[model samples]
Every structure is written in structure tokens, then in C-alpha cells.
Target: MVRVAERLDAVAAGLAEQEGPEAHAALADRTIEALRALRDEAGAADWTAAAVPAVRAHAVGALMQVCPLTRYAFARPRGYPGDAGLLDLIYRHPDADGALAEASAAGRAAYAVTSGTAPCAAVRERRRILAGAIDRAAAERPGAAVLAVACGHLREAEISAGLRDGRVGRLLATDQDRESLARVADRADAPAVATRRLSVRDFIAAKATAEAEIGRFDLVYAAGLYDYLDDRIAARLTRKLFGLLRPGGRLLVGNFLTGLREEAYMDAVMDWQLIYRTQAQIRAFAAEISEVDLAGANYWADSAACVGYLELEHA
Candidate 1:
């Protein structure tokens, strides 16, 4: 812990003395490398509870807060760690311009680093993967019905070829956050995308007979929800989502992997914590589901190898 604090102090000092983006980048690199080494040395133990306060109490934490990306995540203005607005910062979406403009020069410099981390890159790739999945499902079955559970802003829909080309029959995006749903509803592709205010609890409680209420989907995905669920809820939700799939349909879920290099910084600075899982652990979520109702299951990592994806095909 002392070593970690010293490293953070050094980073704070460097950032204070530096004036340009290059200097900020160097300091960010130093901070990332230092935290990664400390995290690696600590191995796979849960230290977030102890580390977050210690890190935040340090000057480096205050310095990092200047960065809009870090501040939004730490503040969690939407009452959640990984809200859609924070994601917009990661996507460098035009919507974040206001926040970026309000940030200090150091903050913008920090944004350039935090927004370009490997995990952030993985998030960007996840969006692309989601869009591609929708396109493929639409190609396989024109006017395919799709569902995005815990869909945050549904930004991927903006770039989905299926939605843009009128190939998707309907896209039902459900979230607990009305603000997030409203953002999705405001998209130009509003006709193809429908927004519903639904929580994970509602889906977990959904009965098989109630499938008609929401309708079965050709493609169902929950890219960001699994990170916050425990083993029981994750498995239950897996079964529930799989049950909502039409014949030959696909259910894709993503979770951060155990070895994420940015885990420590995310925990300490951003105050963001995720339930990182191994590929085997992710696949195990389908253990309770009978093979009779399944076509196949596949697992892969994003380009940055920070996020793992499990794709289950319904028979």
C-alpha cells in the first residue's frame, strides 16, 4: 500500500509540474503501469474496499477528478457507476462535448488517457460487436426481433446496419433508467427502436407464459448488465434470456475478464468495480440450462482481450 501511495504521489507531482498533453500522457502511462504492477503483485484478491479510500484520499485522486471522464464515473450522477452518460465519455460521443469543455486542461489531457485505455477500447469493440450481431441476425432472418436487456442508451443501435436499413423488425431496449431509455428513444432510428423501462429484477421474475408480453427475440443481448450480477442472478438471467430466444436465435452476454490491467485504477480512481470472471466461469452460467434446448455455445474475448463474450444459440 505504501508503494502504491508513493507511486500515486509521484503521478500527482508529475501532472502538476507538466503543462502539455504529452506530459499528461507520460504521467498517465506512469500511473497505469504503477497500478498494474501493484495489482499484479497483489494477485487475484479483492482489495477494492481497502484501496478505494486510500487512493481517493491521496492528492492524485483529486487530480484525476478534474478529468470529466473520471469525475463523472466517480460522482455517478445517475446513481450508478457505469451509467450511459459515462459511456458516452468513453465513446467520445458529441454529447460529452459539454462536459469536456467544462473540464480543465489537465482534465482534457487525463480524458485522452482514460478514454483510450485498453478496457475502454474493449468497450468500443463491444459496441461494434453488438452492432455486427444485430446485422447478422437480420441477415439470417429479415425483420428479426431483437432485445437489449439493461440497454444503456442503446448507442450501438445508432450504427447498426439492420436498424438503419430497415432490416430489423423491432428492437426493444429495456432499462431501469428512464433517462437512458429517453436517450435511446430520441435517436433518429426511433421507428425501429422501442424503449421500455424495465429492471433486471423484472426480467428475473418473468414467467415463461409471459413471453408473449415482450415477445421472443431473434437476437438477445445484455452487454453491460452481467458485470453487476452475482453468480445466482447471472445464471438465472442467463436461463431467462435463453428462454426468450426464438428457434436458432442467439443470446450474447459480455463481462470483464479477471486480468484486466485497468482494474485497480478503475477501482481506486473511478470508484468503478466489476465482477470480473474467467471464460470458464462465464460459460458455467449456462450449466443449469438443459442441452436439449440449446444449439451451441461459444466464448471469445474482445480485441483488447479485456472483456469476454459468451454466445449461446437456441435450438
Candidate 2:
């Protein structure tokens, strides 16, 4: 949504040179410059220590939508503003370090400080999506176990965190890297959320097996996981997760709206944002499930239909 509009705006801004492969690099550079400032203002708020993901979500969502690249497509874990490195490659790639730096510099510039409450309409919608995902799990399995795939640092999303902690019953958590989740787990006040490393094999497990590892969870969510996989993997992962749902279980996926500009800038349309799903695609996924509920209730004014989640239930 926002991505296409931004490219239009960018082309509008730089009509003369908005063409060729060079367009992506040029747009990337402009986006980098913008994100760096946005992040700096975010840092100044000192919320990174408390509302890390929210802050990131707000800053990044706003930046991504307004810019030419989709947030998730250009997303790098632990914070890259303009491109998601592949799961395994992210860990081994030497470029990972540089990308992190890129996130820092570019993210800061991209975000602008506002005097009022978050102007990005998407943030509140994201929170709602999170709440709904949690609620769906609870509703499906009265006492289904829960897990936190990646809690990140802020540790502020406690309701969801508590659900992951065994404190709420059976729970487990997994992350490609442990440090971030550990930051939440290590807290003296940390809830009893069981924690583990995320693995590719776990993705393909049967419903019972998945529940056995994390307990009988009625819902399996990939809040920020979309950014890590390509369309092939995304579809495959969706199929895998579909198998993990109990007869009536659901799997939820999050997508960023707008700002995947690497290709959209000058008519290139590079849709690399964490496997973005259109309304039609969501309808298709719904058809696969015994029941499907797709909601677009939450969105930043600037976001292009990315702040919603898809619910797929097994018969």
C-alpha cells in the first residue's frame, strides 16, 4: 500500500533518474538517510529499554510505509532498516555486522520525533493484532500451552510473555539467537516461560509433536517471523504450521504494510517484504483452513494493509 504510493512519490521527487537497476540503490540510499534520524528520535525517548519492539514497530512501520521499501522485505533482525537477511545467512554472513550498523545509522535518520502520541496509526493496530492472536489461542484451547518464539529485549509485552511462561501453564520459547530472548528470561521478575532455540525441524512437526514440545497449544504464531522467510519458505512454513494446529487450532502471521521500496521506487516493484499476503491470498489461505478469519482492523494511516493477521483453523 504505502510502498507503491511512496515509489510514486519518489518518482515524483526524482523523475529524471528514477529508472534502471541504479534506481534501487539510489532509493535505498535515500531511505537509509531517512531511517537514521527516525531511530535517533526513538532513542532519545529512552523507550528502547522499555518498549523496544513497540518503538521499533512504530518507528520502522512509519518509516517503511512512507519510504519506498516494504518494512519486512528490507527488515534485518536485531535491526536492519532495509533488507531481511535469510535466517541461516544472517548468523553466518559477515555482512550481518555491517547491516546492523546500517540499521542504526539509517533507522535513526528515517524516524522523526513527534511531540504528540505516536502518529503512526499502525502501532495501535499492531498491539491489537497481538492481543487478538493471544486471545485466539486462549479461546481455542482452554489450557493450551504457550510459548514466546522471540521476546526481544523490552520484555514489556508481559501478557503475551506470561502466556509463554509456564506460569500460565505449559509454555516454551524459541529464538534463532538466545541473547534477546534471554534478556527477557533472565529478569529476576521473569515469568516461568520455558525457553529453547528455534529450529528448522520444529517447523515441520505434527500437531501433537509440536504441542508436546511446547505443550498443547491451540495457536501458533509467527509475529515477526515473516521477515525471515521468502515466499517459497513462507508458503512451506505456512503448510508446516498448518499441520501443527489442533483440529481447531490456528496459526497467525504478521506482515508489514507499505515501505518495501527497494523495487517499487522507480516502477521496479520488488516485493520482498517477508512474504506479503494480499487480500486474495489471505482468502486463499482461509480456504485451506477449516475456518479462516482475516482482519485488517489495525493499520497506520500510512501503512498499506500490513498491520493485520490471518487466522487459519484446522477442521
Candidate 3:
């Protein structure tokens, strides 16, 4: 552990001295590789509980000084990891410019590297996949109704051609955070998009009532919700969302895959934790749904193979 901390400290020092994009990129690669090696060496033996604190205390504390992205994640201003604000930074959204501007030159350089990681790439790809799914659903059934559970800012809607061109009948973008919902409601496509303040617990508790009130949807998706749910809750939610689908409608859910190279850094340094799942584990979330209720199910990984998606079609 001491050796690992010393190595990380050296990396931090190198990053501080380096200037320009190439230098930062090289140092970022070294930092990621070092964390991956540390995680491998620690194995899976309660590393989060035992190893993370030591690594953070010894080295990552200083590393975060240079990496504002890691600092924001560690700080978690919205009182939770992976908040929409942090995601904005990851997305390189203009809303994140103020936060980036607040960082020092070295910190901004580090942000560029952290925001460009393979995991971040996977997240960006996830947004693209959701947009494409919405467009496809609208194309298959013109004026399709869609539901986006835990929709953070609904950035995908910005690029969704269906929503842009008025092909989508309605898109109910729901989230626990009013701020996130407000952003979604402020979009140019606000007329076609509706915002609702709904949490997972609220949605689950009102499942029977929700269906009648929200009506059936041609497409339902929770892009980032499953990352925080356990198997039981995930399965239950899957069944509920699947129930909301209209005949021939589709439900899509995404989860980060296990064995991510950034897992250790995210866990220990950024204080971000996720319930990463295997392809089989993702499929198992649909176990409660009756075979007679479904038509087909499929799973695919993002381009970086860091995120896996499960898509189910209703009969």
C-alpha cells in the first residue's frame, strides 16, 4: 500500500509539472494504469472497505488537488455521487464550463484527461444509444409515447431527431431532482417533453396507480438507475417498467459492467460506487417477468465495453 501511494504521489507530481494536452494525456494514462494495477494487486477482498481509505489517505488526497473532476466527484456537491452536475462535466456540457473555469490550469488539464476516459466514453455512447432508441421507436410507431425514468437533464432528447421533428408523441422525463427536471423542462423541445419529479421509491410504491395515471408507453428506459439498485429491487423495477410498455413496446435499461479499469479510482478517490453487473446478471433482472408476457430480450455492450444494456420487447 505504501509503495502504491508513493507511485501515485509520483504520478501526481509528474502531472503537476507537465503542460499541454499530450503531457496531460500521457500522465492520465499512467494514472489509470497505476490504479488498475493497484486494484488487481488488492484483489477483491473487501478492497473498498479496507484498501480504499488507505489509498485515499496516503496519495489520492493530493492527486485530487490536480484533478478537479475527481475533486468534484469526491466533493459530491449535490450530496450524492454521479449527480447530473458531475455528469455534465463528464459530458463536456456548457453548463459545466463554470466549474471547469474555477479550476487551476493543471486542474483543467487533468479534467480534460479524466473526462476523456473510456468509462466516460461509454457514458457518452449511452446517451447516443438512448437517442437512437427513441428515434427508432418513433420511426416504428409514429407519435410514440416514451418514458425516461431518472432522466438527468434528458440530454439525449437534445439530439433525438424524433423529438426534434415532432415525431415523438410525448416524452415523460422523470427524476428525483427538481433541478435536473427543470433543466429538462427548459429545453427547446419542452412542448413535446414533460417533466415529473419522481423517485424510484415513489415510482415503485405507486406502480399500480402509476400505470393508470401515466398511461402505457411505447418505450421506457432508465439509463443510469440500475447502477445503484440491488438485484431484488432491480428485478422488481424491471417487472414494473415492463408492465408499463404497450403491446409491442420496448424497455431498455443500462448498467455499468464489472471489471472496469477505473473502478478502483472511482471507488477510492472519487467516492463513487456502483453495482456493476455481468451480462448474465443484467439478464437475470427480468427473471420475475412471465415468459408469456415477453416477446424477446437482448443484451449489448457499449463501444468501450464498460456499459451493458438490456432491451426487452413486450408482447
Candidate 4:
């Protein structure tokens, strides 16, 4: 591990010294190959956690800056992981195009690989599914009201037909980041979307007041937030969100599945860590909601099998 860390440090030093985008690109390619080789050689000993020590020890943060996604995470502009901007890069949203355009060749190269990974692809799909769920709920419930917890950038609204056509009478999009809420408010269809700056912690604590303030929603979902929560918090949040749903309303939660292909890279290189859950574990969230009607609850993985989903319907 020490030797590998030393080799990575040498490569990182070279990458840091490279001035032009082309030089950075070349060095990034070489560094990526080296990391991949090292990861493969580590066999299945939880390389993500194992590599963290080396990442810190070798001061390879400079090398990781080559990837825009990793750099944003490592930099923590919002002082946290899975920020709205990071999701833009993952979803390949137009919002991220300017950042991509300004990125160095090395950053772009790393982003190309990062954005094309299985988990990233699954995230894109998850957004689509969530959008579709919104449309379906609107169709079933006239003037349906929807709530998106921790709605970063609320990019899924771009692809939502319900929001586009104004079928969704009201969609409350809330996030802890006021900047993210501002971006969502600035969207072309902002009238149809209401932005709120609320954190899960606040929502969980003020359950009664939150329910009274937001009113009942036909569809409520948390797409990426569950990844940061533990089983206890997730289960409790699940129950709370379920309570906010109107009769016949639905609740959906998404999580990265365990054993994701890019788990190691994301943890060690990008400084992103998720509490990955299996399908069974995800279903357990719904099961814990004993007070709710969970007959319609179901769990499944995205097509890429990199993401798991839990959906519950209130009878």
C-alpha cells in the first residue's frame, strides 16, 4: 500500500505541475490507468476504504482535481456531498454545460469517465422515473400536489411532462441549500414549482408543523437524500414522508445499491460516500411504516442495477 501510495503521489505531482489542458489531459489519462490497475490488484478487500488512507497520505487531492465531479465534491462548495451542482454533472443537465466548457481537458476527461459510469447512468434513469411518477400521479389525482424533498436544482422538472403542461397544480420543491432553491425558482416553469429552503433535520423535527405548512401531497419523493441517511434516520424519514401523503398518495425513495461498480472510485477519488442499500434493505423502510397502508409498497433496481428504489402507496 505504501509503494502504491508513493507511485500515486508521484503521478499526482506531475499532474499538478502540468499547465495546459492538453498536458493535464495526458497526465489524467495516465493517472486514471494507474488507479484502475491498483484497484484491480487490491482484490476485493474493500478497496474504497483501503484506498482512503493512501489518498490522504499521498496528498493526491491535486490529481483528483482533474475530474470536475471529484473536484467539486472534494472542494465542497456547499460544504457537503451530493450538492445540486454535482448532480447536474451526473445527470448531464444543461446547467452543468458551462462548468464543463470551462473545465480543463483533464477535468473533462475525468468527467467523461465519471459521468459515464454505471451509477451515474442509473441516476439519470432515476430522474426520469421520478419525473414519470409525477406525471402519473397528476393524471390520477386532479390538480395533484407534489413535494420533492431535498430537491437539488430540481432538474427532473425539465423532463417532466406534468410540469411542462401545467398539469401539476403545485409542486413544492425544498432543499437545504438556498442557492439550489434559487436556481429552481429561476427555471422557466417556476410558476408551477414552489421553492422552499428546508432541511430534512428541520422537517423531521417539526413534523406536525411541516405537514400543516406543506399540506397533503398526492406524490412525495426523495431521490438522492437517502444515500446520506442511516437505516434509522431513513426509516424515520420514510415514515414521516409517508404521513404527509394524502390518501392514495405515493412515496418513492432512491438509493445507490451496494456493490456499485464505481463505489471505490467515488469514495477514494471523488471523496463521495453513500450508505448503499440492497433491495431488501430498501423494502425494510416501507415495512417499518406500520401505521401506513403499505400494501402497494415495492422495491426494485434500476436497469443498470446500480440504484435501488422503494415505493409506497397510501391506501
Candidate 5:
């Protein structure tokens, strides 16, 4: 704890000496590099000497006063890390522009660098890819049915022409947070989208009920959920989602890759944590489903190379 505190103090002291956005941005960049190194070293040692939780909390409190994006994530109105709102901030959704304007000098400096990082850029790309996938599915199967598991705010739907034009027979979205579902429900395109307020656990446990109620889908995908799941749950969820697919349907699952430039900032400042996977590790999850004959299986990363996706298609 003392060592972590010292590191935090060093970062604070360095920032204190800087004035103007340029200086603050430079300081933020350097500080993040140092923090990433410290995090890597601690993880290598199995985190025995790293009081990660304490250090993260302290950093979050300090950054919150200066960084609006970090502050909003730490607040986590959904009572968990990686809420949709946080992603909206990272993606710079139109609504986020107003919030950016209200940021403090330090916050603006932090945002300038953090928001432009590879990870943030990749997140926005991921959303676009998801929308493209939906469009392809709908194009292949007229009036295609789609399912978004643990869908956070379902922002990708906004970019999907299929959903907007009612070509998608139905877009079923499930999330534990009603507030997120409420936002999806309130969208102008609400008529074409259906939402269910249920946690992933409940959906997984009651697969039979879900199958009966929601019916099979042409495209089933999950984003921002597998990162928090362990291997066992991810494998189980994969098998279950596979079962929910119609013949020739596709299942796409996403996970952050091993190297993320903003990882340290996410850990230390936003107190957000995720389980990253390598290409091989992501493929291993797909291998768990031995019962199905996969028509195709492939892995791809976002343009920024910060997020990896495993796509499986049922024959």
C-alpha cells in the first residue's frame, strides 16, 4: 500500500507542476505509462505485494475530482463496472459532448489522451462491426431474428439499418439493469426492439424458458459480457447461445485482447477490471462446443487491435 501510495503521490506531484492542456496531456500520457509498468510488474509477481483494490480506490477518488469520464465510470449507476454510460463516454456519443464541455482543466487533459487511445477507438469500431453483423444477418435471412445478450444500452442497434427498417423480424435484448433496458425501450425505434429485464445468470439458468419464450435467432451476439465471465461460464454460455441459433445462424462473442494501452488507467483510475483473452484462448472457448458442427469459426480484432472477436456459425 505504501509503495502504491508513493506512486500515486508522484503522479499527483507531477500533474500539480503542469499547467495548460498540453502540459497536462503530456503528464497524463507519461503518468499512464508509468502506471502501466507498475501494474505489469505487480501482476508478474502474482499481485502479492500489490494492494490493487486500495490503490485503485485511492486513484479513482483523486482522478474523479479531475477527470469527468473516470468519475462517471467510478460512479457506476448500474452498480457495476463497464456500464453502457461509461462506453458512451468513451465512444463520445453525441450526448457525451455536453459532459466533455463541463470537464475541469485536468479532466479535459485526461480526456484528450485517454479518449484517443487505441482501446477507446476500438470500442467505437466494435459497435460499428456489431451493426454490420446485424445487417448481414438480416440480409441473408429476410426478417431475421436477433438477440443481444447482456446488451448494454444496445447502442449498436442505432447504427443497424435492418433494425431501423423493420427488416429484423425482432431484436430481442436482455439485460439485468432495467435502466439500460428503459433506454432501449425509449428509443424512437422501440417498436422494432423488444427488451427483457433479466441478469445473465438468470438467462443462463433458465435456458429452457428463454428458448421457449424468445424463440431461435438468426444472429445471436454478446458484447461487454464475456470479459467479466470465467472460462467455465463463458463456455456454458457459448453452448447455450449456440443452441438458440437457427440453422445457419451466427454467434459472435467479444473479449479484450492481451494488450490494452489504457488498461492501467482503467484499473487504477476507473477501478474497472476485465479478463482479457488471447486468440488461442478465445478459440478454446469455441472448442468446448463439441456437439455442434460449426460451419465456420474465425477470430478477428478491431482496427485498433484492442478487442478480439470469436465468430461461430451453425450449419
Candidate 6:
């Protein structure tokens, strides 16, 4: 069941919707982990084979109620046709696009949160939108700060070419993955930007962060972590992020677009591949804290993935 899509094409051939949220819902935790590992590999031995890791991992961590995919899977990677389609669907939503315009009009910029460099064209598009977002805000704030989470070695470089221009301010990048962080020092232009190592896991203790970050920030931007977390966990994290913002600070969530809904059996990328979230789901989550501005994303020519960028603010 972990590989619901293993024979999905055959199964989906005759049906309008052959996927379901339940096909692999019953997988055991251990089996789910193994499946995730397999999914990650894409089995050079078997391209036809697929697996879901996030679903299985969540089966253990949150009683299967809040299963999250591995980090990499949340935002679909480039070159994967399966992922590209779903991202397309996400960014084309009419309601979603309208919300983005509203946010852009309000004059809020984005601060991208991630583990490192974005090689995907879709990610590049995501960055462009975020850069625009920050640019909008900078028009009023003089120097808008964009925060990034990247490896130590690559941290400086992410800043120099990525956000060092006069328009963008503070290319704060870091990474929690030590091994990945170590490579930062090896890159030629890596030491140009400011960097640190901070993981979403390290932020599990975010209740404490709220007291300090709230009211001080203009926005909290995270591009790829949403699909990995369940709605409940996303809610908790959103609340924490919300608290950290100044009264009007905003939070942006990034979801890869493949032109598909990505609703059920989403663990194929990890315990699953990408954990899909609807604009409705995001808006619902945002409503729990404050107002949400949802928007469909455009393509990043470099990475080749479709994306959706959302902005939710504290009223």
C-alpha cells in the first residue's frame, strides 16, 4: 500500500479518480519507513515502483493522524513529470490566484525559509515571487529582510547572487543538516552571505520563539515545508510563526505545483512523495490564526516545477 501508485496508472486508466486517501492508510510504521527509503531512491532498479514515506512516518509520530512526508518531497523536485503535473493544478486555481494579488497589493514582501539552493525551475519561480513580495514591502520599509535556512558552507553564496542586490536585505541562510552545512565552506563564493544552521525540527520548541519574534518581523516565508506536515501540525507551526510576527507580520507557505491535486496516497515521495494541501486547507488553517492570502504560483524556468506561494497575516 505504501506504493499506491505502483500500479496506479494501470488502475487509473479506466477510472476518473483511482486514488484515495485510504489505500495505504493502514501501513505499519516500519513498513512505511522502508517504503519511504525506497521512494526516495526511485529504485534505479525500478522506475515503475513508487513509495510514500511521509504517510508512514506520520503513522508513527502522530498516530497516522498527522503524517508528514520527508522534507524533500513537500515541494516537488524538478525533472519528475509526476510532480510537475500536480504543481500545475495548484498554481492555476482561480481562488488561489486572487488571494495572491490581494497580498501583493497590501505591500508585503516574502522572506524565504529553506534548507539550501534551489536547483529546480519551479523553486526559481517561487523565489522570484518571494523577491517580488519583499520588493513590494521594501518600497515602504526601505530595507526588507529575507531570511533563509541553508548549509554553513553554502550560506554566504546563497546571499551574494541570490539576495545581495540593493533591493533585497539580509540574506540570512542556515542549515540544520551538519554534513550539508560543512560543504558550505568548500564552495568558492559561499562565504559572501550571512548563514547559520537551523532546522524545522529544531523549531519544534517554537512556543518560546513567539515571545521574541512577534511584532518584530514583517513576514515569515517558508517555501517547501507545508506538504510535509499534517494540517494539525501545520496549524501549530502556523500559530507559532504567527506569534513571532509583529501585529501585521505575514507568513508565506510554498507548495509545489504539478497540476494535480495530490490529495491521497501522497507518501510516494517519502513515506510519501508530496503531501498535498488545497487552497481551502491553507485558508482554513490561516483563518484559525488570522486572515490568509492564498495564491497559485508560476513556474521557475531553472527548476521546472510549478509552485504556489501563500501569504497569511495577523490582522
Number of the top-ranking candidate, with TM-score as the measure: 1
State the lDDT of candidate 5 residue by residue for 1-315, as single tens digits.
236667766766776676677666775676677677767767745443464555665653365446667788767777899888888898888867888888877788878787788877888888999999999998899899899998888999999988877788888898988888898888737466899887767766875875788789999999789999988888888888887888889999999998876687777666788998898888877766764468889898887778889999988
Q: Which candidate has the top score in lDDT?
A: 1
Estimate, for each residue in 91-142, the C-alpha lDDT of model 2 and write its tens digit: 2224334433444433322322110112123434444465456655655555
Model 6 TM-score on a 0 to 1 scale: 0.48
TM-score per candidate: 0.94, 0.50, 0.93, 0.86, 0.90, 0.48
lDDT of predicted model 2: 0.43
Q: Quick one: ranking by TM-score, best first? A: 1, 3, 5, 4, 2, 6
Query: By the lDDT metric, which is better: model 1 or model 3?
Result: 1
The candidate with the higher TM-score, 4 or 5, is: 5
List the global CA lDDT of all models: 0.85, 0.43, 0.85, 0.80, 0.80, 0.42
lDDT tens digits, residues 1-315, model 4? Answer: 435677676776666655655555555456556666666777556465566667545555465576787788777788899898998988888878998888877678767766777888888998999999999987887688999999998888888888888789899999999899888888747466888888888777875765798798999999899999998888888888998888889999998888765665676667788898888888887656775466588788889888888889888
Candidates in order: C-alpha RMSD to true structure: 1.8, 13.0, 2.1, 3.6, 2.5, 15.5
> Model 3 shows how many backbone clashes?
0
How many residue pairs clash in each candidate at the backbone level?
0, 36, 0, 0, 0, 58
Error of 4 at 160 (Å): 0.7
Model 6: residues with Cα > 4 Å off, grouped in runs = 1-121, 149-162, 167-169, 179-193, 207-215, 257-272, 290-306
The runs of at least 3 residues in candidate 3 whose Cα sits more than 4 Å from the true structure, single-residue gaps closed, are 1-3, 9-27
Clashing pairs in 1: none
lDDT of 1 at 79: 96
